[model samples]
Target: MYDHRKLGRELGLFDTDPLIGAGLPYWLPDGAVVRHSLEDYIRTVERRAGYQHVYSPALGKRALYEISGHWAHYDEDMYPPMDVGGEQVVLRPSLCPHHAVMYRSRSHSYRELPLRMAELGAMYRSELSGVLGGLTRVRCIHLNDAHIFCTLDQVADEAAAALALIGSAYRAMGITDARYRLSLPGAGGKYVAAPDMWARASKILGEVLDRAGVPYEAVEGEAAFYGPKIDIQVGDHAGRESTLSTVQVDFHQPEQFDLHYIGADGARHRPVMVHRSIIGSVERAVAHLIEQHGGAFPAWLAPVQVAVLPISDAQEATAARLRDRCLDADLRVRILSAQDGSLGARVRETRLVPYQFVIGPAEADDDAVAVRLRDGRRLPALPAGDVIARVRALVQAHDTRLWD
Candidate 1:
């Protein structure tokens, strides 16, 4: 098993400084590269699914949470309020309330039955110090948050479509065996407004899950205060389970905020809300990726795709040109030319990186380069252009691991 916390620090991915407090991650340059790639991946997938991206402030007035029922049920996880002038303000712990306000901003007709909104929003939660563990459990998080507002008649179809989107994302990450758990509020858990509403929402969501033929176990008492949810759970190498994604069915918030739309009959009807996060928090996903791949990420996701090495100082010019070509192809490349070390030692050093490209004087004259894959496979003397194209294809396919 790979110890990700140690690897994160050693690889200069992120660090937790004493002065920065617990549950916070300070990302370095390499770590930022990984984070950006993750955001881009999610954006591309969500856009293809017709989600309109939006942005909201990181902080809001205290009353916003109160109206959303978060202040009443989840206040313990929220930060202390700031007295800005005469009003109280708090950092947003979740994006749902903000999305609710956005939904209420315009009058809607039945024609817009399903409206999808997405945001890569930063959120802050005041977590207990003991529960904090590097990027997996942080005080600050960038959430792949999305909300779907649809008419009651369209709820089942929209939910099924969201599930498909989540599955596609997990499959891309090489986590295909994730199990679904339908989480209903338990007798002891905090449920929104009334018990009957909780049961109704859970039943509706479960019916949709069944109709979609999704295999899931009904888990009582795991639901959020405001709704029932479908949790996507996956096990790590140690057999420890974690939530990779969630689709929550919320009935209380729409009524609480008086959100409504005009139906074909000209009657005012409340829209059903679906809250989802396919990748959960970006920080936790990064930690998961590090552990799942044992610090050796796939070719596409690896920070440095190719580390260029020259056999001797005489080959430095050629190596530099190769690095430029790789960079022009939008591939992350590193150049290492060591005159004092043996070629074997140089290769070993380059191996520390995920991919290595070794070019010597002979290959330079031949207009070819030697390729060394991450898993120790060597392809002798391939044209530089051919190698670039192959790498580009691998990246486009989201094949992070090498093709054996």
Candidate 2:
């Protein structure tokens, strides 16, 4: 079992200290590179799917969640509201409330019924210290969250599409062990007091799973307060299961926020909200990737995609030149010169790097580099331009291979 907490520290990916508090691990430089790449990939995918991105403040007026029903049901997991200029405000625990307000900010026509809004936004949760271990549970989280506002008639198709999107993202990230779950409302005061709404939402999610022809377990007591959701579950090295993605059908928030759109008949109609998250929280997603890959991430997600190693001082100048060209090509690269250590030692040090470009005296004179893959495969020394272009193509395509 590869524990992320162990690999994270050994790889210098993230750190948690007493001063920073528990459940608040800060990302190191390498970890930030992985996160930035993941964020960029998600943005591109969402944009291609027609989602409009936005940014909202992390703090919200208490009334915001109150209107969204968090104040009434989910206050236990929320931070205490602070009085600001005689008005109380709180760190948002979720982004749906703010997105609801954004949707209400303008009148919309039915043509735009399925309006998709996405945000790689930050939110805070007041998790108990005991349950907080590494990134799986955290006080602060940046969620790849999005909400789709559509008509009742559009709910089924929109929910189905969201499920398809989640599956596609999982496959791209090389996550193959995830299972589907139908999370329904269980007996609790945590759920909203809308039985009809719960029934409708649960039915829609169950059908979505069935229509998609995926096997899933219908579990009670695991749903969000406002709605039932399709949870994408993955197990860790310790066999502990956690949710990594979700697609939820929400009819309650729209009613709470009075969100509406104009129909062809020119009458006002309430919109249904479909909540979806592709990778859930960035921290947990990276943590899972660390364990899944055992710190040897896919080439596209590797923190340092390439490391240039000069066998001797004779090759340092050529190595630096190659590094500059890689940087110019927008590749994540670093030069590991002979001064650091022997060629073999340097190669072993950056073994996790996807590609190690070793510049020997012969290769430098020939204006080429010998490529060493992370998995111990080797490619003959080739022209610097060929290596750079191929690596750029691999990264841009999100390809898993080191070369063709």
What residue runs in model 2 are displaced by over 4 Å at the alpha carbon? none
- In order, candidate lDDTs are 0.84, 0.92
Scored by TM-score, the top model is 2
**Clash totals in order:** 4, 0
> Which 10-residue window of candidate 1 scores lowest in summed lDDT?
395-404
- lDDT by residue (149-258, candidate 1, tens digit) is 99877777777888888877777776666789999877753667587778777887898789878899998878989999889887655677778788888888898889
Tens digits of lDDT, candidate 2, 292-352: 9988888889989999999889888898899899999999898988899988899889999
How far out, in Å, is residue 257 in model 1? 1.2
TM-score of each: 0.94, 0.97
Task: Record all residue pairs in model 1 with backbone atoms less than 3 Å apart, i.e. clashing.
Answer: 23-139, 186-221, 298-400, 299-400
